[model samples]
Target: MPNLRDHATLHFIVLIWGFTAILGKLITIPAVELVFYRTLIAAILLGFVLVQRRQPFRLSTGAGLKMLGTGMLISAHWILFFASANVSTVSVCLAGMATATLWTSILDPLINWRRIAPFEVFIGLVIIVGLYVVFRFEFDHAVGLVLALVSAMLAALFTVINGRLIKKHNHTVITFYEMAGACLGCILFFPFYVRYFFPKRGLVLVPDAAIDWVYIGILAMVCTVYAYTVAVKLMTKFSPFAINLTVNLEPVYGILLAFLIFGDAEKMTTGFYIGTLIILLAVLAYPYLNKYFEDTKNAWKDRRAEKRAEKQALEKQNTTNQDPALETIKVNR
Candidate 1:
């Protein structure tokens, strides 16, 4: 089990991740360019760490291509994630991203060709109600919320794909390749991005301000590289259940931090908060609900086994009680 310090460290890492949207808003660069630089720097940092640790850097061509494809999804996810923050308040963006669990619940069964868990579907519907409440009250930020929701869907897709890939490859190596792929994707898309999206400004690769560079650096290095590596290490000590349950709090932490930093700008309607609360409750309850179902199934199995044992024992007792005279006759024969 992880000690208190380990738990604290994990929360600190999550806090850094929570700060990511804030950092995205604080930086003056456009979302696409921001993702490009973030991935580029993070890839370089991770690659250096891999080389220093003498980790293998090569993969089969097929796996490399798969990682590259997945990288595109990651790139899209980050772009929309940051764009949401740019267009609306950080709380709104994070609130939408918080629905990622609901997306995963729907996608995982379909993608993996398994029966959908009914409880998961029930919770997912609850999340939808929450979203409706938010949308009804905060129609002005609809675009941002929609963008963030798309980002969450992309996140769920990539996560499911990564889950499959990690079974056969080193997690760190997979992350490095994915980051490299994301960076390459950003580079390839630059022309289209400039021609269509921002015809007036042209291509702006570097941050205009020095302080923006600082924020980007912290985003790439501390948030992506350091936190990712440390979280992987922590997996050896903590259960995945524990880690994921804690990660569900990222939106909560982010929203609170956004309020703290941006003050009145981060405030939202009562309906918005109610919606957020409902979504978070569903997200947080998932693991416990899953565990409960599993435990109940196991207990049912145990009870059946006990009944079978008792039935056999009683049958044997009945047979022995009637068999003494018959046994003597059979022995004599």
Candidate 2:
């Protein structure tokens, strides 16, 4: 098990991840352009790390291609993520993203040929009800919430794909290609972006503000690359269950940070907070529920086994207690 320092470090890394949305809001570039640069810079830095470590820069062609394809999903997820924040309050964006784990829970069983846990389905419904309450109160931020929900879905899918790919490929190499792929996706998207989304100025190819560069650099190097590397390293000392439980706190951290940083701008309706709280509670409750059911099931099995042993023992006692004359008669026959 991880000691106090390891756990603290894990939380710190998660805190950094939570700050990502804030960074997105701080950067002045459009979401599409922002993702382009974030991916590009992260890719370059990851590449440099690989070189410094003297890691082989090779993979089976098919795996490399798969990573690249998954990278496109990563790009889309981030574009939508930042766009959601840019368009509406961070509260709405994070509230939607709060369901990503539920999405993963659902997707994992379906993809891996396992039964969907009943608890997952119940938690999903609870989350939906929470979302409904939020949408009812914060109706104006509906578009942003919807965008964030879609982003969460994509995030879930990318995670599931990565789960498999990581078993075969080095995580850094996978990330490097995915980042490159994400950048390539942005480049490919520029034409359509110019045609439909940003007809006026096309792509905002460069950051106009110097502060934007600083934020982008922090986003790429610190948040994207460094946080991921550290998290992966921490995995050696922590269980997946522990890691996931802690990660569920990301939305909480992000929302609170947003409120502290943005003050009144980040405030939402009371109902919104209630809804978000409900969703969070359900998400956090899952592991405990799973353990509870598993333990109960084991208990029942143990009780049944004891009862079975007692019954067999009683039957043996009855057989051994047979009269001696009857036993002798049977033996003579």
Candidate 3:
């Protein structure tokens, strides 16, 4: 179990993650531009932190390329995440994102060579039903919902990839490379996003208001950089499931914060609330199920170890008796 301070820090990081939606809404820039700024700022900040910590800032060629690829996926996820918020209400965006666990269940076995759990599949199907309810009611926001689902899949993919990388490297180093890749992806996509996605549709990248800078700063600094760093650090102490389960609260925190900040604009129909409730319930249920299975696995391992130790003790006693007889034979000879 994590210490109290760790628990506090974990919640704080999740809170920042939850607030990202509000910041996305408050910022005036387009999702592509905003994500571009976010990745650039995060990469810069992580670079400085890596230097300060005196960790090796370089990686092997293959590893470096892999990290960058992972970062690009993350960049895509963030872009879609923010775009979802822009096209739909924050509540709907977050509710859609709550399917990340379901994505993980389907992805982990395929990625990590593990057997799929039937219960996980059943629960995941339940979550899909919840999503179907939301989609049926919010059919007008179909594009945004699809974007959010894609984002969740991307998020799950990189998350599983990161779990393997974190074992061999420091969290900061891993983050720096990923952030660098995200920056590169944003820059590469900038011209295309502007020319094709924006102007072709007659949308603007630059917001008219000066106050947008403050929101961008909060989104980049507090939410992206700080929250991501803290979460990475926490992974050293917590299991991936534990960390993700905690992060699952992002929607709840975001939904409440959206209501508090945006008030009447954030309110939804009774069906929407019911669907959100079902999704959140799944998020809350994951930790308990994970804990139960983990504990069961540990207990089984302990029993096996005890039996092995007992067998070793009996073998040693037999060896000791045989040694005395062998000594007697040597003396008689």
Candidate 4:
């Protein structure tokens, strides 16, 4: 069970994640510049914390490479996430990301070589239906919604990959590698982004106003570095499913924050709310359903093991009592 600190930290992480969208909206820089700066700051701040605490910064060369690769995916995820918010509303971007659990369900089997349970498929389908409802009627923001879904897919992939890396290394160490990778990815993409997306436009890298600095600080220091590390630590106590489900509430929190910050611009139609409720319902229900299925699977495995043990015991008794002639016949047979 989660303790008070666990609950408090989890909620705080969700709140920080919620503010991510708001910060993205408020920053004056473009998505590329914003993500580039965010990762750069987060990497530096987190590196300082790790060094101050005297944590190990070592990983195997192969593991370090994998972390860097995952970090690149994380960079892509954030870029898409912020771009979604820029083109559409925070609500749409967050709502689409809420489907990450569904994506994980589908991807886990392929990555881990496990049978994909029917229950997981069923739950995933239900979430898909909710997303369909949201996008069908709210088609004005379909492109942004799609981009957010792509972001969610990338998020799920790297998140699962990180779970493996965490078993062998500290989260801070892994995070440092990933942060470096993200910075490199943004640097590599900037030239292409400028050529294609902002052709003929002069470089606009720095924040224009002091207010932009505030948003950037919140995004980098609070949301990215601090919140991410805290959540990584909490995974020792809470299940990933539980953590992720709570993360779904970030959309709810973000939408509310959007309303408070942007007021009329954040308001939506009745259909949007209905779709949002359906998505939230699916997000909340998934953890319970997953736990139940896991329990059932373990129970069945225990029963099978018990039956096998009993059979082995009976066979041993029969063998010990065997007559010489019968033993010889059995051997010949």
Candidate 5:
């Protein structure tokens, strides 16, 4: 467990992450362009850090390519995330993003070729029910909600893949490459985006106001880079499970921050709140439930092993005594 200061630092990190959504909304640009700038800046900053540390930038061909590819998914997730806020209330967007836990629960099993625990399945269904309630009450924001949900799924996928990659590589190296890839993805996407989806003469590459630049810088440096660095450092003190459990508070922090920053624009209906509460409750409970089940499973395995050992020992003793008795009888005869 983390101490009080560690807990505070963890929550502060989460709060910074929550602010990213607010910054996205504050920036005046298309979601695609926003992602491009964010990725570019982050990649540049991370590269400088690596060079300063004298760390090698080179990686195996396959691993290098894999990290880069994962960047496109990251780009898509942020694009959808910002777009969600643009299309609807920040509260609604955060609510949709909250379902990321549900998506991860489902995706992790299939991706890792592991069985999905019964508890995970049950929690997923319950989350779906919460989503349905929100949908029924806030029908007007349906498209935004859908976009946010898809973004959550993408985020989950990226997380699962990144978990594997991190085991064999330095996180900053992987992230630097992924940031470059995200930038590349945006470059490739720009032509098609302006030609069809956005339907403009050219890309909206520049920020109109100075504050927009300020917001974008904070989004990249503070939220993306700083927060990640802190989390990695704290990993030595906190188990990954504990860290992730704390991370589940992201939506709660985001929603609160949205209300504070955006005021009336962020408020939603009573039903929406109820449904969101349900979803959050399930997400927050997941780590504890998973830990309990995992411990129970290990206990059962140990008990069975002990029983088998005792039975084998008893059988060997009975066999030894019977063999001596049979030998004595034969000798007497």
Candidate 6:
């Protein structure tokens, strides 16, 4: 079981992750360039930490390739995530990303080869309803919302993949390779990004302002390196469901922070808030509903077992009563 400290640590990690969007928006560079720098810096930092701790970075070729692919997914997730915020308000971006839990519920069963739980589907439907509400109110930001939703799906995918990888590798080692892979992935995409997306400005490899550098540094070091490393480590103690459930609170923290920092810019219509509340309620209520259903199932099983035992006892008693001669013979013997 996880201790209170473990839960607290996970929440702290989520808090850091929540700040990531604000940092992304603060930086002036395009989302792709920002991801490139973020990943490169994170890779360097994690590499230094590994060298200092004398941790080996060796892995099988197959695993290395897999990590690289996972890194590309992570890169896409970050690009879309930041792009959503750039195109729309932070609240809209976060509201769209908040659908991650629902995606996870759908994806986990398929990925793990488990039967889909009806209760999980019900919760997913509830979240969809909430998202619909947000969509209806914030129709102007539909494109950004769609991008963020896709980003959330990618986030859920990589998370499930990491759930498999962490069992066989150290969290730090995994992060080092993944970050390196993400950096390389970004580098490979640079040409296409420049050609198609920013043809007019060309490639933007550096931060435009000094404060942008500070924000990127915090994003790479504090958010990416520290928070991600700790989150991966905590996965050893916490189930993916529990971790993702807690992460549902990210939007709550982020939106509140955005409201405080960006003021009116982050505020949404009343319908958006209502929609967000519905989604949050479903996310928050999932664990309780799961536990209740599981407990009920277990209790029913226990009662059935007790009934079987009692029936067996009565049947034996009746058998003994019917066979008095045999019982008497045995007793005499």
Q: Write the per-residue lDDT of candidate 1 for residues 174-246, one digit (tens) a residue.
A: 9999999999999999999989988999878777898999999999999899999999999999888899999
TM-score, per-candidate, Cα-based: 0.92, 0.88, 0.88, 0.91, 0.95, 0.86
Per-residue CA lDDT of model 4 for 61-162, tens digit only, reads: 898899889989999999999999999998888888888888888888888888988878887877878887888778999998999999999999997898
Tens digits of per-residue lDDT for model 5, 1-333: 569999899989999988888888899987899999999999999999999999998998999899999999999999999999999988888999999989999899999999999999989998999999999999999999999999999999999999899889999999999999999999999888888986755788888888898888898999998998899888989987889898989999999999998898888999999999999999989999999999999999999999999999999999998998999999999
Off by over 4 Å in 5: 319-333
lDDT of each: 0.93, 0.92, 0.85, 0.87, 0.92, 0.90
| Candidate topping TM-score | 5
RMSD of 5: 1.8
Report lDDT (Cα) of residue 309, candidate 2: 100
Off by over 4 Å in 1: 301-333
* Top-lDDT candidate index: 1
TM-score order, best first, reads 5, 1, 4, 2, 3, 6
TM-score of candidate 5 against the unseen true structure = 0.95
Whichever of 4 and 6 has more TM-score, that candidate is 4
- lDDT minimum window of 10 residues, candidate 5: 198-207
Tens digits of per-residue lDDT, candidate 3, 1-333, equal 789999999988998888998888888778877887888888898888878888787889998999999999999999899999899878888888888888988999999999987768877978888887887777887787888889989999998999899778877888889988988998898777768877665445466687887788788789877787777779889987778678889999999999999999888877777877887888678777877787898999999999999999999999998998999999999
Residue 42 C-alpha lDDT in model 5:
95
Backbone clashes for every candidate come to 0, 0, 0, 0, 0, 0
